[model samples]
Target: MPNLSTTYLGVPLKSPLVVAASSISSHVDRVQMAESAGAGALVIRSLFEEQIQLDSMQLDEFLAAGSDSFSEATSFFPKIEHGGSKEHLMWVEKTRKAVSMPIFASLNAVSPGAWVTYAKQLARTGVNGLEVNLYSVPTDMGKSGSDIEKALYEVIESIKAEVALPVAVKLSPYYTSPANVIKQLEQHGAGAVVLFNRFLQPDIDPDTETLVNEMVLSNPAELRVPLRWAALLYGRTRLDLAVNTGVHTGRDAIKALLAGATVVQVASTLLQNGIPYLSTMLLDIQNWMDERGYKSLDDFRGKVSQKHCDDPFAFERAQYVKLLSSIH
Candidate 1:
């Protein structure tokens, strides 16, 4: 069997297939199943700052609603303390204890202070690492791309200063210059970078004139974006690259590795198929490697990247032009 072992953010993984942060990690049994199914590591569902804030607000409202009803009822609440992120912290720690594989906690926050505070708390959850989700849709017209990048750097710097765990930044693909932003992240102490963060876009019900929000899982076709970026960034930086979104099978994972990704994080495929499907993907990779006579991932990893590929512009616009010309 070909050696599938690889490392990410300095943490060794038996395989390169990582479970991306999603609802899949909500169940402890599923997490253990992922480990059994051959996942290298798992990133727990993110602890959103907005969710914590909303919970705190709801609790405050409930506590104050009946406080003014009567003097005796003022203490009726029993001085209960708001859980805040206590439940999420406990969940992360519980999941960590349930499996022997590396468990990485994810955090999504809006402010620098919140990022640092939550990162510190998550670092105490016995997780092997942290994945910071920089997910946001910029609606403010006044904010320039540089401003957004600056805020990201500040948050990264703050979290790195406050926490001891390795940090992986899950970046938004909409950046003006993703490579430049990635370089900045490296300078600010990010150990790794997830190629792209999938954003959920709301749809409109034209007949009812209402907004509809639904979860749409990724498909294999979505792999191209990260694939190109991974190939482009292979030899450009020292940061580990994790290709996420659109990886559905063993060949997809191999494609990522060939493009120089340190590992491939999958969630949609597992959710759409089944947890056991992870082992199938790994088996597919192993079979393909054996057939190709590749003993280890490094044997051909980055072999097709822009830095090493025969066609240096394969991931560039020249290829795009060639494809269009060929279409005619």
Candidate 2:
């Protein structure tokens, strides 16, 4: 059997396939199942401060809307149980006790003080590491791109100051220059960088004249974006790069490693398929390695990356233009 062992953020993993933060971590049994099914690590569902605040705001709006139209509406709703960071901290601790694999707690979109406070509390849970989901949406017209990047740096620095756990920042791909962001994060002591965070885009319902706000699982084609960037960034920085946002198969995972990704994170794929399916993906990757006579993941990890590939320009826009022109 080929050696699938690899390390991310200085933490050793059995394979490069990591279970991304999602509802799969909600149950202790499920997390254990993932580990048994061959996951490298598990990132618990995020403690999303912004998501909690959004829920609160919507609740207030609901009460206000009903206060005037229906007097009984105010009394009908149940008390909001946002579960706050305290509840999340307890749950993460429980999960940590249940599993032997490296457990990472996610803290997303937190306030200034909450970043330090929650980060400290989470680190106390005995998790192996932390994943900071830097969910930045550039909606504010006044906030320049530089302002957003600076805020991200401060967030990481605050968390680092509060905790000793290895931390990885999950970033959005919309940044003006993602490589620069990674360089800054490396300087700020980030152990790893999860390539891209997927944003929930709101759709419109023309018939109802309302919005369509729901989560959509990613498809395999979405892997291209991170694949390109990962290959381009392979030898450019010292930061560990984690490819996410469209990896769904064993072949997909292999592609990421070939492009120099330290690891590949999956959430939607597990959700769409069964959790046991993880073992299948791992088996497929193992078969590929055996056929290629690759003894370890590092044997050909970056073989196809820009640094080692025959054509470095294959990852750039110049190649993209040439391919299109050649087609006609």
Candidate 3:
């Protein structure tokens, strides 16, 4: 068997396939199952700032109403139970004790101060690393791209200054210039970058005139966007790249490595196909490596990146030109 050990963000992983942040960590049994099944690492479910703020507002409203019945409403605030920065820290510490594998804590913050404060607290939890789930929808027409980018940088810098643990930023694909944003993030002390976090999009029901909020898992086709960006950014920056969003199989993970990704983070696939599927994925990668006569991940990783590939223009040039020319 070939060695599958690889390093991500300076932390050694048993393999390159990490279990992305999802409902898997909500229960201890699920997390242990993932490890036993062969996950390299695991990111705990994200603690969303929006959910915390909404709960706080509800608690305040209940208190102001001055109803004795409001006492029971306090349970609605998960932060008071398992969602606060301190509570999250404890959870990480507990999870670390439960499993020997590397565990990374995740946080979704809206403000720079909250980002810094929570990152510091999470660092004390004994996690191997931290993942910043940074996301914001630009609903205001007055805000320019520069303004949004500045906010992202400020948050990254604040968190970097406050914590000693390795930090990875999970970004949205809606940026006007993702390459520039990633370059700036690395300059500001980010250890790694997770390509493309899938956002929850709202849909409208025209017949019923209702709005719907759904949690749709990513499909395999979603891998192309990150693959192209990873190829273009490889050898250009120092930060490690972990591709997420649409990675569903061992072959998909191999495609990401060929595109210069340091590791592949998967969630939707494991959710769709039970946790044990991770073991099969790792086995498949090892078998492929053996057949190719590659003993280690570094032997073939990034061999097909834009900088390494013969047809560099294929990743950037418009495909329409080829289609139109061939039609004649």
Q: Model 1 Cα displacement at 30 (Å)? A: 0.6
By TM-score, how accurate is candidate 3?
0.92
User: What would the TM-scores of all predictions be?
Assistant: 0.97, 0.90, 0.92
- Candidate 2, residue 64: Cα displacement in angstroms equals 13
Q: Model 2 Cα displacement at 309 (Å)?
A: 0.8
TM-score, candidate 1, is 0.97
Better-scoring candidate (lDDT), 1 or 3 = 1
In angstroms, how far off is 107's CA in candidate 3? 1.0
**TM-score, cand. 2:** 0.90
Of the candidates shown, which would achieve the greatest lDDT relative to the real structure? 1
Q: lDDT tens string, model 1, 169-239?
A: 99998987999999999999999999889989999999999999999999999999999999999999999
Each model's lDDT: 0.94, 0.89, 0.87
Q: Write the per-residue lDDT of candidate 3 for residues 1-328, one digit (tens) a residue.
A: 8888889989999989889999988888889999999899999998777777887778667555654566765455444332456566777788888998999999998866888888887888899999999767888999899998888888888888778899999999889889999999998889999998888899998999999888899999999999988888888889999999899999999899989999999999999999999998998898889999989888887888888999888788736589779986
Worst 10 residues of 2 by lDDT: 77-86
Give model 3 RMSD, 1 decimal: 3.3
Q: Candidate 2: which pairs clash?
A: none
Estimate the Cα RMSD of every predicted model relative to the unseen true structure.
1.2, 3.7, 3.3
In model 3, the clashing pairs are: none
